[model samples]
Target: MDWLLNADTNGEKFLVMLAAVGLFVVVMGAVLVAVDRPRWVPQWLVVLGFIGPAVLMLVFGLVYPGLRTAYESFFDRNGENFIGFDNYVRVFTQDEFQIVLRNTAIWVLLVPVAATFIGLVYAVLVDRTRFEAAAKALIFLPMAISMVGASIIWKFIYEYKPDQPGVNQIGLANQVLVWLGLEPYQFVITAPWNTFFLIVVMIWIQAGFAMTVLSAAIKAIPDDIIEAARLDGVGGVRMFRYVTIPVIRPALVVVVTTIAITTLKVFDIVRTMTGGQFSTSVVANEFYTQAFTRFNFGLGASMAVLLFVLVIPIVVYNIRQMRLSEDIR
Candidate 1:
């Protein structure tokens, strides 16, 4: 019992994880055995057996928490007194929050587009190259590392040193400048540019995902379509532009929209690198600051709701594009 409440230790967390797995297995096994031993379980009950646990998990995990957060968004900081819409209004109109929104906008705009484009080009270049396997693996390695780990690695690479003579520069960025006979620069201390550097780290991590998804999509393109294009004298950049991109257009949209949603909710890179300071705070980081750091639960709830609202349109667009692409096929 104490172990359940004390999850700070790795052992306790592992134990709790095991208990959860054990509970799930027991419940599922009982359900299976009961269903099998029954005289004649109805078809609806069989279907329910398959979906019931998932529905229960969702109702308890997502639906209730989402509704509660929405409700709390209209209340005051402490959630005691009702303060309708004040938190929401402040989130939209306040100067500090505006900066957060601005950073979030930059992330959503840049991460998806840049990552997807770079990935598309890389995928095409290495599709059947001599060193295709090795090249793709090297590019995709970052995705295997967690975002927090990637941020830490890049942060070390972007490390800054005072431009003092006779001092060896430790950070790679500074070291490069030193090699070029220029003074070492502060990568994280600089304002908006620092945010861009953080964005680059995200791009590096997400480019692999985009590349993998887009590569599969490209491979799934029909062999006849590509041959027909070549027969019609379409090759090189023109073929890629007209044929390859169009054929994989649905996947492109899904990848972009998926990355956009991921970027909108990005927190780890910013948190690990900048701690949301110096105008680098985005909506996700701001939400954490409000909810946990500042103990402003209501305001945090509003920000969460705003994030949810922001993702809806992109998701809807992705669904529409996917359906339209299917219709075209």
Candidate 2:
């Protein structure tokens, strides 16, 4: 038991993993055997046999952690004293956390809208074009890269060096400025606008995802609806505004809300590029910085809860939109 608990060695860790897998297999096997005896076992017991483990896992993993974090938010930094919303008050009122909230708002506002727009336009333009696959592949390439990898790639693009006589600009963006005979600016370290620069990376990565989803949605639009619109003299932008937009509205909402949720939880890009410095921190990264780096458990838990609360409304609205769309169909 001690060895299982403290598995420092590679062999011990592998053994522990095997033990867990074996235990899972044994438990599942027992459940299946019990369920297979339909005549001997009650129907409810058979249903429970299938669902009990999953329910237990969900309760242990999600519900308990969420409730625990919410409870912890009401305590002090050390988590020893009950502070009762003080941490949440600091989150809303403090200048530093105000900046964090502002940055998060900016991220949620811009990334989804900008990414979805670009994707929709791209999808529309390249819908049936000759270079459609190639163009889509080029745009979707960024989605294949991990967030940390994408951040590193963009960090190099925005890399800054002193404008010395001997120095050459390695960053593509800085090089463009140099070519234009303008001095290279600090892209990441500069406050406020630096946040926008970081946001661009997320947009670049998510634009591909938005395009993929919206493209499929566009393709799913009935040809007869488009034919009817064309016969009615609707063309170009007007056709898109009326026929295309209305047809894909549900998909558009899903894409936007999905991206917004992702944007709200954006941490890797900001953490990798700015480390939450220079007013570039969002709620997710700020939570990590508070709980882990700064060791302020109360504040961290509060931010976590705040993020959860913020996401709930968007999620509920997304679900409602999806259901409404389904009902209409």
C-alpha TM-scores of all predictions: 0.93, 0.93
State, as a TM-score between 0 and 1, how close model 1 is to the true structure.
0.93
Model 2 residue 309 CA deviation in Å: 0.8
C-alpha lDDT score of every prediction, in listed order: 0.92, 0.95
Clashing residue pairs for model 1: none
Question: What lDDT tens digits, residue by residue, belong to model 1 across residues 1-329?
Answer: 88887788898899999999999899999887767745599877877788888999999999999999999999999999999899989998999989899889999999999999999999999998899889999989998898899999999998987777678888888899989988888888798788899999999999999999999998899999999999999999999999999889888999999999999998998899989998899999999999999999999999999999999999999999988988986
Query: What are the per-model C-alpha RMSD values against the true structure?
Result: 2.0, 2.0
At residue 151, give the lDDT of candidate 2. 97
Clashes of each: 0, 0
Tens digits of per-residue lDDT for model 2, 1-329: 88789999999999999999999899899889879986898899998998999999999999999999999999998999998989988998999989999999999999999999999999999999999999999999998898999999999999998999999999999999999999999999988799999999999999999999999999999989999989999999999999999999999999999999999988999899989989899999999999999999999999999999999999999999999999998
lDDT of 1 at 299: 99
lDDT (Cα) of model 2: 0.95
The number of the candidate with the highest lDDT is 2
